[model samples]
Target chain A: MNIALFGKLIQLLIKEKMAYRGDFLLSAFAQIVSYGGEYIVIWLFMKRFPLLAGWTWPEIALLYSFGLLTYAIGASFSFVQMRELEGQVRQGTFDNLLIKPINPYFYLISRGFNLAYVAHITISGAVLIWAIGQLNVQWTLLNWAYVLLAVVSGAMIQAGLLTAIGAATFLWVRAGFLFTIFFRLKEFISYPLPLFGTFIQLLLTIGVPLAFVNFYPAAFLLAHDSAPLPGWAMWLAPLVGPLVYGLGYLLWTSGANKYQGAGG
Target chain B: MDSFELHRYVYKLPVNAFREQLRFCMDLLSVGEFAHKPVRQLSLGQRMRVEIAMALLHEPRILFLDEPTIGLDVMAKDQIRQFLRAVNRKKPTASPGRNLPGRSLPRASLPGALPDERRYGVTTYMMFAVKSFTNQLAYRSEVWLRLLGNLLAILIQVEIWRAVIGSSGQEGASLDQMITYSILNPLLLALLSTNVSEAVDSSLKSGSIATELIRPLSYPLYLLAGSLGLSLYKLAFTVAPAFALAGLLFGVLPPASPMNLLAFVAALLIAMLMSFLLGYLVSLLAFWLMSHFALSWMLGGLITIFSGSFLPLWFYSSGWAAVAEALPFQYLGYVPAAVYLGTMTDEAMWRTLAIGLIWAAALLLLVRWLWSRAVRRLIIQGG
Candidate 1:
């Protein structure tokens, strides 16, 4: 794909959304309120109980904010594309992507870059900062660098999982249900993974590896020496994102190759 | 000893009359050979014929059908149509009503005469409700998806509550009560939740609102009936099953008293009406707004927090609780669940329910007035 053409597509999408200024603003406000509600729930729970699975209110807030930030960035691109893929596949409109000179996965990802996610990122980033302040963590430059890398990696891991799930539409024809499962599972990592039982902890760690998206990195940043997983696992968080995303891209390509028209 | 016998055993009708009706249905629908098979084992067409036979056994004056031949083969459709025509001929007094507004009118009436006396009325709206119920029934996979999601949500709630209460309980509710409250919270909300806003938004966008206007029924009433049907279907097939499963796994507590159960049920029914009216009012904003997406999200957030879907209003500060009590959102989910849990006294339950009823009435009038204004705007703007 040409960089200029991709930039032009993004610009056009933003312009189209901006055409309905009232609707866009309303939608953005709604996103803020919705994300804020999640935080309020967390805050209320913490108020009721000072500790959630051995994490303080500020510590859990930080984890939740990181999860929200990564999810917002990842879902800004993948969620709508995954939702629309079933219809596109069934209607045979997906063939248009294959015929384009650009890589279909990149095209698909770029086409659905929603600006509304700015609301989520802004709100969650603000919460993260507030949470850091409340916790009074002595942040070194290296710590800040690790936080940045972890955020990028977390976004990749989320986008990769969603892409893999979306790829299933090519084979299953009705893979929308899988997206719901993924969404619910994503909610699991929004808090300390230790809050859950062994089964869920293991599932998030190894089965889906959602822990790398938020829990492990947040635990590391918070310097929770009693973190449930092995000490070495925290250091591996950055690699998980690129590795998972690479596998997801491969899955998308194979699914695209296997794609037949609606007639099939 | 066949399908006829099975119907006889199930319905407890006079054997001779039941046999005659069964034979008539079999002969009319050309499914005589399938009579001996169990209903579950029969093909879709054969089962549909049996269902029609069962429905007509009472021999009511009007017969309502919602997509009676959907998913059937051409031959099956033809045969079913023929059978319905035969039934119409045999009992000319019995009017067979199909749910599609203008389709399946009598052959004697021309296309222009589509607005017959039976075009719109209570029965018609009920038909719409039944149509929605059957429509939901068709999406079996969606039901499973919803069930799985609900179960997972309940599990998460249980985990959260377990962590919060942890060998002690909060004020006004024990751990057992909280668990029961969490399980029933979603059930009550699911029963009241409607897609009216989304439906209205899309219809306005697609210009289908025009067709709805020309129909004999009021557009708002039609939407209300359809949404009611959908909620009922969800309550029966989705919420009840999930509640039962959660109860089995997590040990749900019983209502504190029989009176609480009665009051809870009444409050729940009123809450469904109140929810539909609120959703309808939100949906009406689509007439003036460019899109309802943001409005719906705002409404959802308001309902989630104010209605106390995530946590009980009692947990909030007194000021917040006062605000919640003054609003109608709490009546949608919180009040009914509280009544069931006996968190509210009998007097308090009655007072809250009376307020809910008043809100429903006020919302109904408001929606009706706004609908007229919307219709006028549409006409003036040629929308």
Candidate 2:
């Protein structure tokens, strides 16, 4: 990707979004309220139980906020593209992307950067800060580095999943139902994995591997002394995101090759 | 009982009256053979005829037929058209309206011959509602998607509640009650909520609002009627079946008592109307704002939080509860569920119902006032 061109595209989109500032602000507030409502539900539950499966309120908040942060970042870049892939294919617009000099995947991902997800970042960032303040963890340079690495890996995992789902549109023509199911499943990783039964736990861990996106990494950083996962598994969680993302990218390429256009 | 017998029982009609109406319907629609069969076993056209007959059993003043010929063979269409014409000729007072946009007039000449005095009334709104109900039948693919989504949502909630309640063994609310509340919240929201705001916003964007403005009826009311029709359809076809299935699978709690069930139904109706008014109010804001998407989202967020859809009001702090009570959002979801669960006392239920009615009346006025202003703005802007 041309860094300058990507920056210009983002700038232009921002400008366009700003033209309807009132609508943008209202939508952003709505997004904030949506996430805020989820946090409040968690808070209310924490108040009732004091601890969820062995995790405290602030710890759960940290896990959820990290998930939200990475989801927002990934979605800001890829959501529209992923959602519109079917429409573009039906309209023969995907052919234009393939004809471009740039890598089509990167180009598709770079275009249509949604600034509305700033609301997600703001709300989740606040929760993360509050949770950290509540925790007695001794933060060092290594811990901070690990947190940074985990956040990026989480974003990659989200982007990968979305890309793969978008690629499925080539065969299905409309992958919206699949997207909805996956999105609902993604909501599971925001809390402590132990609260779920073994079946769901295994499903999230290995079936879709959403646990590697937020839950396991956060557990390692905050509660390593009593992390639920095996010791090696906790350490290996960060690598799972990139590995899943790489597999998803390969799936997308293969699906792209198989695309014979809507006429076919 | 078959559909015919069930309709008679539900309507509390005398045996002779019910038989006469059923015979008239069957003879008119040529569905006498299918009348004895279960509704589920009927083919689409056969079911449509039965539904039309059932809808006419009450002798409604205005009859609305929405795509009455949809999915029918050519012969079936001709039969339905002939039956409708015969019905129209028999009841001169009841104007039978068919929503056929582009097609030439049928031999019946219903819409064109309707007098000006009969053009606007309760019957017209009822027709709009019926039209909306039938329109939703076309989207068969959405039913599975909606069922899956609702099922997933219920499962997630059940799991979360089980985990939370498991820790303390109990909370502010009992586990069973909480589960019931969670189940009803989404079901009611799905049944009551409307995309009217988005619909109005899109019409405004596409410059179709101009066509609506030229119509004799009030645009907002038209939208409301249409939404009511859509809601009724979903309640019957989607929400009811989904709720039944979910309840069977998850074991939902029944209403606390017969009285509570009555109060819950009343509260639910008021809540749905209030939701429609709120949606209309939000959409009218599109007149001033360039886009309504953000505003609609913001309204959704407010509803999600204040309406207690995500969490029951009892779970909130007293201070937060007071704020929520002061607002109209609680009437949308909380009051009805609370009443059904018998969480609120009889006095509180009455008070909440009273408050809900007041809000509905107030919002209705606001919607009317804002709609006039929106129309004026549209006129000024040449929208």
Best prediction by lDDT: 1
- Give candidate 1's TM-score: 0.82
RMSD of 1: 7.6
Q: For residues B1-383, what per-residue lDDT tens digits would candidate 1 score against the true structure?
A: 24345335333467688778777877777667876665556888878887787677756577667677778888888777778888889989899876343355432211232223443446557767877887788687789888878887777777877787766774567888888888988777767778999898888888777656644445677788899899889988899999999999989988879999999888888888888888888887777885777777888877876888768888776677798899999987788889988988788889888888888889889988998787777777775
Local error of candidate 2 at residue B43 (angstroms): 28
Clash pairs detected, candidate 1: none
Prediction-by-prediction clash tally: 0, 0
Candidate 2 lDDT, tens digit per residue, A113-180? 77888999999999999998999888999888888888888888887788889889888877877788
How do the residues A1-264 of candidate 1 rate in per-residue lDDT, one tens digit apiece? 368877988999989988987788888899788777777766765676678778899898899889989988888878898889999998789999999888888888788877888888998999999998998677999889889999999998998898898889888888888888998898888777877788888898888988999899887877775255787788899999998888888898899898886664
* Candidate 2 chain B, poorest ten consecutive residues by summed lDDT: B109-118
Clashing pairs in 2: none
Candidate 1's C-alpha runs over 4 A off are A225-228, B1-120
| Model 1: how far residue A195 lies from native, Å | 2.0
| Model 1 per-residue lDDT at B372 | 74
Model 2 residue A163 CA deviation (Å) reads 0.9
Docking class of 2: acceptable
lDDT, residue B10, candidate 2: 34
| Candidate that would win on TM-score | 1
DockQ values per model: 0.53, 0.40
